[model samples]
Target: MESWGNSTTVTEFVLLGLSRNPQVRAGLFVIFLVMYLIAVAGNSLIVVLIVVDSHLHTPMYFFLSNLSFIDVCYVTTSVPQMLVHSFTERPTISYGRCFGQMSIAVCLAETEFLLLAVMAYDRLVAICNPLRYSLIMNGKVCIILALGLWTFPVLLTLVTFLTLQVNMCGHNVVNHFKCEVQAVLKLACSSTRINGIIMVLASSFTLLFPFIFILVTYGRIGFAVLRIRSAQGRGKALSTCGSHLAVVGIFYGTALAMYLRPQAKRFTNREKVMAIFYGVITPMLNPMIYSMRNREVKGALWRVIGRKVGK
Candidate 1:
């Protein structure tokens, strides 16, 4: 990863960020700044709530704490930098820093997808195998799963980056904001055929496979829910799964649109807009979705607030 390509030395990349107009950039700066703050504060609160409350010490919240921590890191990976660049006249990221951010983003994003599938399976076991849920998803099992979920993505990212044998030849103007893998690939003077193959293989494991697994897992959960004779019981089952399903739909929808689309279509302004949905919107919405739908989370929030107020 030297900045030097074969012919020319490339030291930095100029980012043609989200907007060009000064007024538009100013407005975007304000809006995205607010979004960044809200996402950080909200996810941070979820992590805090899960940690401080005994009621949230179950396998589900343990995974959620991981999710919250990931979301905080995920958004922080790009948003703060993006915010600063938004208002600046010339937005640039160093060659080394650009790939550094991309690698971190990949690790966090892929880990979130894998963690979501694990959460779905957790819900399935809890709902379908209620009698042995605790034993099945015991403390040791949860720890191992969390470790795998986090570890696999880091390796995937590292492998993906190492395999990208790209030569820039001094071409370094990135069209979109941030160092998105696709956008960077488009700048390669060398053939990206090998890089494309590697990315597709990696995306299959990180995005497509986990998405299918989640769908199948949820299908079984749906069937099990239908067997519940009581309407209340059925509703409870759906409520438990609903929050997770909603998050999955938003995440996978945006991600598939971003990664799995026909590669013939080059990275464009539309792609940058699409990236915001998963990159910014989903992380902001995760805690709100879970807290609003989950009574336990709401209860924990109140109890924590009550203690502070009482003191």
Candidate 2:
């Protein structure tokens, strides 16, 4: 153990993952491994499809590629660490490494939230002001928005991380598998009130704000769809936003369930399961949800595959 600040000693964290039972661990390993593989393959395919298909060279797919990339990063942050913990009898993380993991996880999570918000707004502009969609979401504007989404998370994570550094001293046995902000803070010998407050505020911005924006955007969209005189027109417009709505529902529903309440020791296993949904399962599902349901994406993917096979 190493002393920090005044005289507090900090060492490593013990990650209590899914199960101690070998059989259970094996089962979970298989399940999670499948989820991880799907997440990587699905998200990668989306990125490739978007890049190679000229038909997908639009602001929507541009945002989607970014979203898929973030999803890949997001799942990778936690799942691999958890997998290691599950197999190994003794799993430990160094203080510096734990902090770094926490920082990256939080940053990527916030980035995903911001990206979702940007996508929502893009849909809003596309649906509400169809004529102005091109002007509103031009390449330059998209780049600026994307930069803002990426930068804000790093700044927010830095603030939270700095606050955490002050508290990280003494036996760091993080009960959770991953380096969660709450789990790490619980190990601190020093005061963590400031860290808790910052977490709540950041969570509000990242989770709740995007949720509200999505709700309002979709509410308006629903009203607009109802007003369309032709059923075909309404169907067409609704189809455009359906995939995004599905993604938002899954991502936000799981996130709100996990973070809306106070962190509890008893619910650690439950939290881990829920974390799998948003962090791993959702990412895997996003590409499939969009590609399978959306005609344009499916068409583009088919064409790309056909071209490759031909060559």
Candidate 3:
């Protein structure tokens, strides 16, 4: 089938970011750079603490470490280039590079979704079947689930990239800070039916299904918490899941708003703005959410820093 919408003769795309105003772009660059540094430092610290702290060797921290690693990859996939482009007069991306960015972003995003789902299940088992929690989420099982979470998304992203390759020629202007899948797909000169289908399927698997799982798991957890007589018990239970819930809400909310929403040319600017929430802000927030609210992570971070300072 012929590609949908207008066809361009160029192979690569030019990213027209938020502002052409030099002052505005300069300010954005500085702001994003600061955010990027914070994201890297915060997420990296989480990963380091998880590795060093023997107390954090459980399934929960296993998933938390992986989530931190994914966040690092997630932000790195798009943010630096975006920061540079914000300051540069002409921001151009090669077709291959665009595909690479999309592939990495989609893979990491989907992986995080799957990881979050696994975490919810972990929480469910811990709450609902505390005795069998260790059996169900043994080291072997955790490794297998984490592998699947990471690999499945990589495969899906590859398929999407192949699908896009068939129709990507000319009119390379991408009106966003990064080469988002939907935005890039809009520039294709070939039928996007396959791409759309794949995207929807991936979204369903990665976003909708996991969301439902988290809701159900949390519902069960809520019931379990209610049954506990001690107020401390109830508070502890809520505390365990609260950060994950917040991260889930922010990440999925912006992601769905950008991808699942109707595609209109007029919404491009709005979409780009929303993309920043998930791509940049969420990564930066995850570490803070866990560090400030999570007792174990905070303790581990403090210990690590204290050791470093002593050294």
Best by lDDT: 1
TM-score of predicted structure 2: 0.92
Could you give candidate 3's per-residue lDDT for residues 8-74 as a string of tens digits? 4555678889888999888998999999999999999888888999988999999999999999999
In the range 139-239, model 2's lDDT, one tens digit per residue, is 99999999999999999877765554454555556667687766666666666566667778888988888889889888988887788898887888887
lDDT of 2 at 229: 90
- Root-mean-square deviation of each candidate, in angstroms? 1.8, 2.4, 2.6
Evaluate all candidate structures by whole-model CA lDDT and list the values in order. Answer: 0.88, 0.80, 0.83
After superposition, which runs of candidate 2 have C-alpha atoms over 4 Å from their true positions? 1-8, 165-169, 265-267
**Per-prediction TM-score to the true structure, in the order listed:** 0.96, 0.92, 0.93
Maximum-TM-score candidate = 1
Query: Candidate 1, after superposition: displacement of residue 92 in Å?
Result: 0.7
Q: Per-residue alpha-carbon lDDT of model 1 for 1-311, expressed as tens digits?
A: 33222324666888898889989988998998999898999999999999999999999999999988998998888888888887788888988888788899998999999999999999999999999999999999999999999999999898788767888877788988889988988887778887888888898999999999999999999999999999999998898799899999999998998888667536799888878888998889998987656889989999999999999
Which pairs clash in the backbone of model 3?
3-189, 3-190, 3-191, 8-170, 8-171, 9-170, 10-170, 13-172, 14-172
- Can you tell me which runs of candidate 1 are displaced by over 4 Å? 1-8
